[model samples]
Target: MFFILDMFILAGIFGFLYGFLLQKADFCFTASLRDWISVRDSRIGKGVLVLIATAMIGWGIVLTLGLATVGEVWSMPIGFSNLIGGVLFGIGMTIAGSCASGALYRAGMGYIQFWIVIASMMIGNLLFALVYDPWASDYVMEPLQLAEGGFTLFQLNLPFLLIPLVIVALMLFIAFRQFGWSGVWQGAKDSLQDFKGNPFTKSHWDIRFVAVLLGIIATIQFVVMSSISITGPETRIAGVLLSFVFGDDFVYQNTYLNGMFADFPTIGLGPEETLVIFMIVGAFVSAILSKSFRIRKPKLARMPYAVGGGLLMGISSRMAPGCNIANVIPGIGGLSISSLIVVIGMAVGVFIATAYIFKMPLLLFQKMDFDDSGS
Candidate 1:
């Protein structure tokens, strides 16, 4: 009992840190991709890359110290699952105005729209779990054993230091050309000054600060939790809800759902669920403390889009076997081939959603339609 309590406490601490930093930085994956596509603003995207690079470095150290192994890289067939799932997720995020992590944190900030998204996402998960196998066999190819012959950057035997160094060098080059040394220095100084103020009431941390903190938090999450993801908790919630509605054996009886549970067993509120709950609590507290908490009721017309978006997000996340936070951030950090495939598919999906569905300008320098009042 004491051990369980301690685990919950630790999960809550990590979740709270994740929520607080995410809110302060406004680090929504959807927003990062949209900004880069629409306005050529890559700051948030670069921050994401920084986070991945930092995680890679941290993982390298962990491996060097024999604290962990690289065995966590997901082994799945390289096929249409990634592309289709990623595309769906991208479309869902665009319509919902946030990804899974973004929705969770924003919902904590009292966004009614995100609540709808969450509910719809649960329904999507339940539905997809019911039909995963046929979809997998029809679309996904034969399973590739990553440890045996499957591809991964880590399999290439490259120096562990090379990946992070390359990413950092690219970021520096972009920053130097875009902001210059003086501008960058001034921005850093301003960020420092902002940090010196009362974080609870006066100001929030800068994006760079949030990025570094997220990297460190993710690293710690790996060391402590043995897994890092925001979607796992939602999956547990869906499973529990299904069991309540259908019967206790609902998840265990179903083939796909059973397989899912095999990987992430739902035996009461697990650490992931606890982490998610605390994430919401932490975000709410942060919002209240920052005087930013307010009920953001969506326009009635937008509710349908939110629901549809969320449903798509849920389905795609499950099909891909992970959401952006689960598949993209940690996946990239671990140099998984599946992550690379999913990223490509997501980029394509984002392009289609932004350009065709949302009718946003695809080309850089093109004017963006800021008015989202109409569908």
Candidate 2:
């Protein structure tokens, strides 16, 4: 019990730090994608690449050193669900202007719309549960009713780890040529100083600096928790919420829930749920310290978009068997094929959603600045 308590404490600390960094940087994956796709600004997008590269490298070292086992890492399997789920996830995030974790942190920052989004996410998950019996065969894999036909890249016999390493090396070279090592070193120095000072209101760290740190933090989460997932906790929390409406015995009728949430023979809350709960608390603490917590009412016109986006995200998260964190971090770190497919699908979804949202004609060059007021 003390060991579990220790893990929970560690998870909370990690969550707090992550929440602090995310709030300080105002980093949203959707915002980054919108910037890259709509206005052609790739600074945050490039930072994301750096984050991925750093994480890939870190996970490679961990794997090579045998610091983590096969069961310790979360790798999505090869499946069409990844592609389909990514499309829905991308579309939802673009519409809502926040991904799952983004919504959580922003909710902590007192965004009423994100709170509504969170509620809608629970609704989406519950709705999925009600319909899962008929739905899993078409979109999800299972060991119960369905025979899953997919495998992770790590399960392959070839030199799959080298692919991520080589790609990371190439990205490092490109980064060195573009930004130089001295700039990064200087940025790190400035970042540490900023961390020690007034990071809430005033920050001097480059996004790249934060990006690299985020990569390292992500790797740490994997090493400590066996795997990192943002949506798993969401699902578990949603399940807990639904248990109030329908008893646990009745809710577990959805076999998918049985497998995913059940640690042994039971389905209930644990460290994973605590991690996300603390994530929200951490974000709240950050907002309080930063004086950024304000209950801003949602725009009347955008409420539907928020709810709709939340529904899409929740539904797709289960379908993909993961979310942005699931696919973008450890999944990619482990060189999972499903994650790669999901990335392609998400890119395509973002392009289509952003274009439609902006009412932009694809054939024409766009000079209008990306508007985030709706978010």
What is the per-residue lDDT of model 1 for residues 1-375, given as tens digits with 9 covering 90 to 100? Answer: 223677888899988988887887778888888878876788788677767777777766665566766565443445567667788888888888898888988988999999899888888887787776556444442352223333556555766557756766787788789899998788667655656657766436677767777888887788777556766568778787788788767678777667656654343566777888777787888888888989998999999899999999888887665788877667777677776777777777777888888878665644334333333
Best by TM-score: 1
In order, candidate lDDTs are 0.74, 0.74
Prediction 2 global C-alpha lDDT = 0.74
Q: Write the per-residue lDDT of candidate 2 for residues 228-264, one digit (tens) a residue.
A: 6777777778887776778887767777666666563
| Residue runs of model 1 more than 4 Å from their true location after superposition | 1-3, 73-77, 133-151, 263-266, 362-375
Q: Which ten residues in a row have the lowest lDDT in candidate 2?
A: 363-372
User: Residue 307 deviation, candidate 1, in Å?
Assistant: 0.7
